[model samples]
Target: MRRRGIDALTHRAVAEEAALPPQTVRAHLPTREDLWCAALQYTLTGWVRRGEEFIDRLPEPLTLEQAARAIVEVATVHPAEHADTTRATIAGVYERYIQSGRHPELRPLIGRYNVELTGLVARVLARHGRHVQPEIARAVLAVVDGTVVYRLAEGETPIPAAIRALEVAIPLLCPFPNDT
Candidate 1:
């Protein structure tokens, strides 16, 4: 159902595809929105799980560049598995988040993860370059997210492109001593 994209799915269609009775499918997913949300949430959970695993594998006190590179790499590698649905769902979620004033419960989860990532970046900036600022960390994150979205939309998983972009942007954001 997911591989074919959201348009290909209906309650009856999904039930048939799953070889389950329509009523049984309806019991689990009462509406098209429910099905899509479930699929998206499932995809998101997998992403979160992968991120946790990657964090666990990291050496203590990962530098900003290392953390950024790790995140880009993981996002690049995993999203290629379900690029279509995942991208669509991400677009949907971002739109919903922007359009509605209410925050989703998942917002905190995302914020916490981002805080950890940006904090690492800020630490690296403080240690290796000039003063670190919250805005600098945020700009770095925006670049990474934009790059990931672009690569996913192009049906390409170019880790090198992401890495290079981050490497270039990092200095601009932090302005290392040699950058001058």
Candidate 2:
């Protein structure tokens, strides 16, 4: 699924990729939609896990800049480690974004993802003994997402742009001082 889009997903192809029997793949996936759902969930789950791990590894009493950097890294660096993986992850993300618009069932999942992201930003703010309005947090997320989408589309590194924007906005959004 990471290597190809939903249309290319099939029990036989999955079995071939997994080096398992087609019957076993069918018994597990049952249908193309089921397979696609599982594959998408699997990718998201892995990404979330890595993100949690990255947050867990942060030093105690995180500074505002550190917290902001963490969020940026989780949103970008941790999801895509290599060129191919980066392309695949971007493809999956845009595909889901398009699918959510066309499929109402996915809107709830997308909403939940947004809520979780908001909570993450809130937690990061709290850890630094700072507070940002929900609107500001949402704006920060929008900046991050927009930067990432731009990077994926243009095949350019937009980290400097994102960091510069965050450096400028975070202090204004919260009471914390920019140590960097």
Candidate 3:
């Protein structure tokens, strides 16, 4: 589902990708929705785990600037070096996010992701002494999501350059001046 869009996700395709028999895939997944929902859950759970690891690695007595950059970096960079795969995952998630509008059944699953992401950003901001607000967290997420979408749309912006740009832009857009 990451490399290809939803339309391309069929039992045979999934089985081929997994190097498993079609019968095995069908026995496990049962239906298309079951497979897609499971895939979404797996991808999102991985993302949340990575975000937590990034936060754990932040420096003690983290300055506002460092916190801001670290948070943006998590949003922008793929830590396991699977940048392309990560990009594909993001694209897949974005598709599901859009599909949820029409399908509705995907709402709770995708909505949990939105809530988790907002909470992750909010915790980072608060760690750096910012007064945590839901609006601020949502705004930060919006900027990150928009930046990522632009990167995907253009297919040109180098991830490193985009990461640097986001690090610089975050403080300007949502300043958290260092009191240290």
Candidate 4:
């Protein structure tokens, strides 16, 4: 569902994209809700993986500025490559995130995502030698989510706006800075 919202996802479409028989796809997904959950799970898992991978690539004991910038840029779109695909994925995730209120089946997935994301934010802060409460980590997530939605609503590239907003907002969100 990277190129379209979850509403557009179908077993046939997925089968075609994956070059598998439609029956195989249906056997795995079974229903629209199943497909929706699977698609969302895939996207959400990728997002978490992206953050973990970014962190893995960093040198040990990151500087505050490095960790701050890494947290801002890690999960957002990479501007120079696969820009459209990244934008679509980001939009699709937000769309799924909002759908959790209407679709009870999706609430578990969203909850898991939020927990993982909260940990990611916290990890970035810890890497910079500043440990924060879970609420503060979630606030970091809130800033990025709000900025992304605003940019998307304005028909602009969300990544740049997210970067700009996070750079300003993250320091303020952290409880305190470690002088290391």
Q: Ten-residue segment with the worst summed lDDT in candidate 2?
A: 77-86
* Rank ordering of all candidates by lDDT, starting from the highest: 4, 3, 2, 1
Q: Which residue pairs of candidate 2 clash?
A: none
Task: Arrange candidates by TM-score, descending.
Answer: 4, 2, 3, 1
Q: Estimate each model's TM-score.
A: 0.58, 0.76, 0.74, 0.81
What lDDT is reached at residue 149 by model 2?
A: 75
Off by over 4 Å in 2: 77-95, 102-105, 132-135, 176-180
Candidate with top TM-score is 4
Model 1, span 1-180: residue lDDT tens:
335555565888878888999999889888776776565556555655665565556665556566556655444323333544455544443343332224354355455545655655455445444566778877876776787667757866445556668777876777756667
Model 4 CA deviation exceeding 4 Å by range: 75-89, 177-180
Top lDDT hit: 4
lDDT of 4: 0.75
The sequence of per-residue lDDT tens digits that candidate 4 reaches over residues 1-180 is 767766678999999999999999999889989998998898788888888877777776877556656665554623323444566556766777777787899899989988987888788778877788989888887887888788788877777566667667766777454522
Candidate 3: tens digits of C-alpha lDDT, residues 118-150? 788877777766655777777776766677678
